[model samples]
Target chain A: MKIIVLVKYVPDIEAGYQFNSARRLDRGGDGLLNQLDEYPLEQARRLAEQFGAEVVALTLGPDEAEEAVRRALQMGADSGVHVCDAAVEGSDALATALILAAAIRRLGGADLILCGAGSADATTSLIPVQLAARLQIPALTGAASLTVQDGAVEIRRDLDAWSLQLAAPLPALVSVNDKTGEPAYPSAKAVMLARKKPVESLDLADIGVDPAAVGAGGAKVEVASITPAPARAGGQILDSESDDVVAAFVALLQANALI
Target chain B: MSDILTLLDDPAREAERLAFAGAIGRPVGVRLAGGPELAARPGTVAAALATLAVERDAAAVLLPQGLFGAEVAALLALRLGAAAITDVVAIDPDLTATKPIMAGTAFSRARVTGGLAIFTVQPGLEAPPLAEPAEVVELAPPAAAAGEDRVAVLGLTPRAASGGRPDLLSAEIIVSAGRGTGGDLGPVEQLADALGAAVGASRAAVDAGWVDPSLQVGQTGKTVSPRLYVAAGISGAIQHQAGMRGAGLIVAVNEDPEAPIFEIADLGIVGDLGEVLPAAAAAVRAL
Candidate 1:
């Protein structure tokens, strides 16, 4: 079996980011792979190890995003592919999917493609389904646990009220949530070995990607602005002597029917 | 502007309203369902459809992605000769464009190949759009009498454990405590009280039994994007940060200056949370 794990490089959420004069994130320094993406990477690695399958980590971003692919390799991916090009920048969800679909096709396709339910930065959570649609495959999302056997993939999905177990044929897309398991940390030995592994860099031209299908022109929604959210007003703490504070708190709760 | 109409089931009205308003303009009609005679009478869905057909003359219909709404939207789209787009987050300008992909990690631009594209937006991804006063024209109850759908209301029993402030998803301010709270929830509550913030706990603190599991925030728990988030004694973990990283302002109070929480915090205080929180609360009150 062959599996492809889609990964993304995101700004470290814990990093205090300041927008440069261009109103974009300052990315000259290092940023880590999106924390959510790790779950899928680990799940892919474990599945590959269990089935003796080949696992490939694929990422689409700027050239600097190679760090994310390297990290995936260090974590046990058999090889890595970087779909790097300036044309990929500022691409909205649609453009990104088109590029990824093109790359997946170029890679000779796979028996399965796994992705995190959502990325930390955008949290759009729309990639996997769109990719499945483009590839004409069944896509299951919000999967808490997944297993492969007898040429079919069984998955348990977390719904609002109950868990649903469904099975799909091979050559399907599955978006795994972090509930699957905690992502494993790479060992020192794996990190050292990752350097020797091959990471193929593919440009938009190499993948036969049309420039118009990516970047700003392909984006549907325009970000009017990115401003700070409104500030929250502090509340008064009720003291033993202050009936007003106590009354206000109780009234607020009652009004919302939370009492 | 192209108008978008959203249908509502009164029982899920709040969520439906938020979902609709978050996606398009003010919803045109509000339909009530699950009455005592509903089983014997015409379904409210028919009435809602009629209202959309006659009054709103809705160009398109939208619903959230789920079992009931998905079925309804698909049926309505087919009936109206509208193109169907499922699991969409945002509609582009001209109303003819749609961008729906996987939970939103990637997007694909698609135009309504046919007229009146019906789409469903995923909940929790897009914020509800602002409300505007629209002249609501209520229709008389459907005369067909209720028993069309056999789905019965066996008994409506609300869940307990509902007293924990606003959900982290909708809360504007969150006061999250970590291991440094010393298993004493008093000070954390006091701080939450001062700021009118919802109480949240890190997975580590929750695992330590310092807080309830329901209050845990992280990749494994709830994702929150509050306007202001205050972390006390929590050394930011990548998993935890994934949940609250979208917060507008982050303030960290930790005894260790090297704590990872400080790295993301806009304001950092290297001191005991027990001391710092009380002082900060008092200062906020004074202001």
Candidate 2:
């Protein structure tokens, strides 16, 4: 069996980020594999270790995104693929999915395709569905737990009001959340070995995508404006160390009818 | 310009959704009352909605914000060859949709450069309800086309609605904890119980395995807009603030004097949560 895990390289949000003049997130900064994608990557690695599935880590981003594939290799992926092209810089969810689906097809398809629930940078969570639409496959998203057997994949999804168990036939896509497990840290030997792993790089043309059909020119959504939200004013802060503090707090809640 | 089609999965939110859609264009509400089996098949649902949109010449589609909203919206967008937006908080007459970005520190106002607009509107906007009920037509999930990929519902476990605490998404009041809890949510749950509020946790607490991932309140978790939010032991990172900033009233308790949560909180107390949360819960109970 073969599994393809899609990964993304996102700016370290904790490192502080800024929007560029085009209202796009400035990707020029220290970056790392999106923490969310690690969950799916870990799942792929587990499948490779236990079921002898061939794990291929794939990414679509700038040159910096190659790091995501390298990290996946250290985590036990058998190979890596990075689709980097200048024309794909400003692609939105739809355009991104078009490119990724083409890349997956170029790689001869897979029995299973996995991705994180959402990218930390975009937070749209649209890619899994978009890719499924473009590729004509079943999409199972936000899976808390996942299992594969008998040419079918099943997952438990925790929604706001219900927990649903869903199943789909093989050649499907699944996006998992953080509940999967903590990703194993790469050992020094694994990290050194990852450098020797072959990573195939491709561009828009290589993926059979027209340059005019992607990037800013082909983006369906246009940013009109971006502004910082008005700062909320700090209200009264009381010293709970003082006597009658609990009473004072309770009175406030009572006044608001919140208690 | 054409009519905006609003997909109503929950009738209780009809007025707000219609009002929001009405601002963009003429509102044509389509009520979708699919059962669990149909709801599990987003592709079939999207196909049906796409057909409806075309038959009605819809310039845009509005869907309820929920678990199925984004996926169905994406599929519908793909079918219609339109642009899709989710978690929309505002829309201008010109159809510019505004949503939170960078974890709610900023807002991104965007418009479809071409074709149709598909959106999942966040609930609880300040828009006034329609004075009269709009016409709502029931929509049924169409049969899946031949050779189309479909998902099967193997099983389902409905969360107890009334007998348990309110779900985090719809809770009017929320009591959230953070790293300061020291991996203990006991006091947090107590306060939540006394106030009938849902319990939430910061990413730090959730990462530390102190709380369920469903109970996490942050950028990567669930966004909530409650009537009142009481945050305990949380320093209020930018991501955490994103989830609760829409709340009407916010109260924070932290030992640190300069915790960022106090910046946006309407009321704050500086003290150890170990002492403060239990005391607050006890006081509320006595009241």
Off by over 4 Å in 2: A232-239, A242-244, A247-259, B145-149, B160-167, B178-186, B193-196, B203-214, B235-239, B255-268, B282-287
lDDT of 2 by residue, B1-287 (tens): 47888877765777777887776778888876666555556667788888888888788888776557887887777777788888888888788999887677678899987777888887777565666666677876578632244688889887544337777877889999899999888898899999998888898998887777678887768888999999999999877887889888888989998999999988888988889889889988987
Question: Per-residue CA lDDT of candidate 1, range A121-209, in tens?
Answer: 55555466557656766665666788888887777654333345656678887888766778789999999999999999999999999
Predict model 2's lDDT versus the native. Answer: 0.83
- Cα lDDT computed for each candidate against the true fold: 0.64, 0.83
Best by lDDT: 2
How many backbone clashes are present in model 2?
0
After TM-score superposition, what is the CA distance of residue A196 in candidate 2 from its true location, in Å? 1.8
lDDT measured at residue B65 in model 2 versus the true structure, 0 to 100: 69
Off by over 4 Å in 1: A16-29, A228-259, B7-26, B29-199, B205-215, B218-287
DockQ, all models: 0.05, 0.60
**Ten-residue region with minimum lDDT total, candidate 2 chain A:** A240-249
